[model samples]
Target: MAKTNSTAVAAALTNNQIKRTVDRLAALKAQIANLETEADNLVDLLKYQGKGVYFGNAHKFMVTTVTGKRLDSALAQSFLTPAQLLKCMKTTSTTSGRLYAL
Candidate 1:
């Protein structure tokens, strides 16, 4: 039937689009991972010998010290009562979608 053929074509097109999107996402993930590694290396080199700042021809880098308290969730869970644990917890929801290659 014409309707069946049209539906098939639409499904094929949707699959192709999903594949392309997934491929693009994979490429972007690779690029981001590479950039993160490079950034981490740069940070380590710059932070060596207690250096705080570096001036370059195209970029400026500065090291900042931040102090904060973070909860040790595992330790807290072991020691705290259920009610106490609940008091320390905050719940959040995130919505996201991903396409994968088959």
Candidate 2:
């Protein structure tokens, strides 16, 4: 008879659980996107702005202003230059983990 180690079995089960959780999360995000589109359509139909409520749930509506700067490469090359732009830029590094099924 072959003996199986309990520790190995537990680790494999844990990995499988993690993979399943990731799959479930992806499905949930897709559902959320669909729901958000529906909500946006309803808000547009009602011409809602600033705040509102549905089924006794309190909701606050907001208009967000997003501002960004785009570099004029031609001007930058003639004047400040790419090297100068690099000097002002901030670089970030991050580490992330993903679970996969076998």
Candidate 3:
């Protein structure tokens, strides 16, 4: 099928117009993802260069290195039986939502 070229910004858009707009939105999102990925690599390079504050023409950025000890859940589970692990485990509920396009 062909494509629609209705770049209308009214609330009363036709079905095809909405579809075309969604297509444009998805394209823009893809472009943003590509840009963010590229910039993230540069940011990683800055982090590797060392943790310090940096300044641009009008902006300042900081690279910080955090040191902390994290628990190894898999290793701990190996050292503990199922009953012991269950006794030590804690449960929590969180509110979550997601949007899907199909």
Candidate 4:
């Protein structure tokens, strides 16, 4: 009878341990799911919203004129003429520097 009680106790302990492990695993899974959802939300916020100039809106934006100081004299001197710069713009879809898509 003593051996039987010991065996029963061990079996109960094992079952409780297994149940606790399963519960812990389930909670971890739920936490991962929530994290994934938050990650997706953050990605949506960070990525280009495709709204600025790509979408045709009723609002008319002011066309800002480039000041003479804005032009790099050294860089401008590299090109033969403004026509060369215009040609480069026509040929290249994307510029080497930071791109502002219009």
Candidate 5:
């Protein structure tokens, strides 16, 4: 029934705290973008110099060529009728969010 020193409970955030949290998230996103760019560059360099698999201190980075398949809409449209094209096609709905400077 009684709380101990180790029992940590979160206090409710104020309106200002909410805004500060959002601000922190926005800054983190920017940092993440920069880090991603640097990582991509490093990966490219490693792929050029290293073999198929890269050895890190605690992890292994495997670089493999990915062959993807997708419908050639323009070519398909030329060959198939409108009704046939509609039958073959699929509508994909995806969700994403971004923060803007206002």
Candidate 6:
């Protein structure tokens, strides 16, 4: 019958739409879980480091060098604290400026 055929087509379309929605939701849930896991790991690492001590991951020579330059500019506000400058020196290219306590 014509009515039966139309009803079957409508049911198929509804099923297809529901399937796509569920798939998208599952993908979003997976991405959220991954982000949460990364946040938890970072929080745990920070907790392990406690207060005052800095927490940093090891980097290659070039990455370290770039990071040093960025830090020098970035930390200029904190009176360029000795510890920060020393951290900069370990990875720096600059040799003219001597670090002094403020």
> Using TM-score as the measure, which candidate wins?
5
lDDT of 1 at 25: 81
The lDDT for every candidate, in the order shown, is 0.80, 0.69, 0.82, 0.59, 0.82, 0.60
List ranges where model 2 is wrong by over 4 Å.
1-13, 43-57, 60-74, 95-102
By the TM-score metric, which is better: model 2 or model 6? 2
C-alpha RMSD in Å of predicted model 4 compared with the true structure: 22.4
Q: What is the lDDT of residue 93 in candidate 5?
A: 100
lDDT of 6 by residue, 1-30 (tens): 367546465564567786775676677777
Backbone clash pairs for candidate 2 read none
Give the alpha carbon lDDT tens digit for every residue of 24-88 in model 2: 87787779989999988977855554344333257655454468999887777788767887897
Candidate 3, RMSD to the unseen true structure? 8.8
- Candidate 5, which segments miss by more than 4 Å at Cα? 1-18
Per-residue lDDT for 1-102 in model 4, tens only?
Answer: 467546465564567786775677677777998999997885555444533332237643232335575667568758658777666554447645332222
Q: What TM-score does model 3 achieve against the real structure?
A: 0.55
Q: How well is each residue in 1-102 modelled by candidate 5, as lDDT tens digits? A: 645533233246679986896798799999999999999998898888755888889998887877899878899899999999889878999987678775
Candidate 3 Cα outliers beyond 4 Å, as residue runs = 1-25, 90-102
Using Cα atoms with residue i matched to residue i, what is each candidate's TM-score against the true structure? Answer: 0.63, 0.47, 0.55, 0.34, 0.68, 0.36
lDDT per residue (tens digit) for residues 8-66 in model 1: 65564567787775788889988998999998998888888474777899988887788
Per-prediction tally of clashes: 0, 0, 0, 0, 0, 0
lDDT of 3: 0.82
Q: Looking at candidate 2, what is the lDDT of residue 58?
A: 72
Instruction: Give residue 14's error in model 1 in angstroms.
Output: 1.1
Candidate 3 residue pairs in clash (backbone atoms < 3 Å): none
**Is candidate 4 or 5 superior in TM-score?**
5
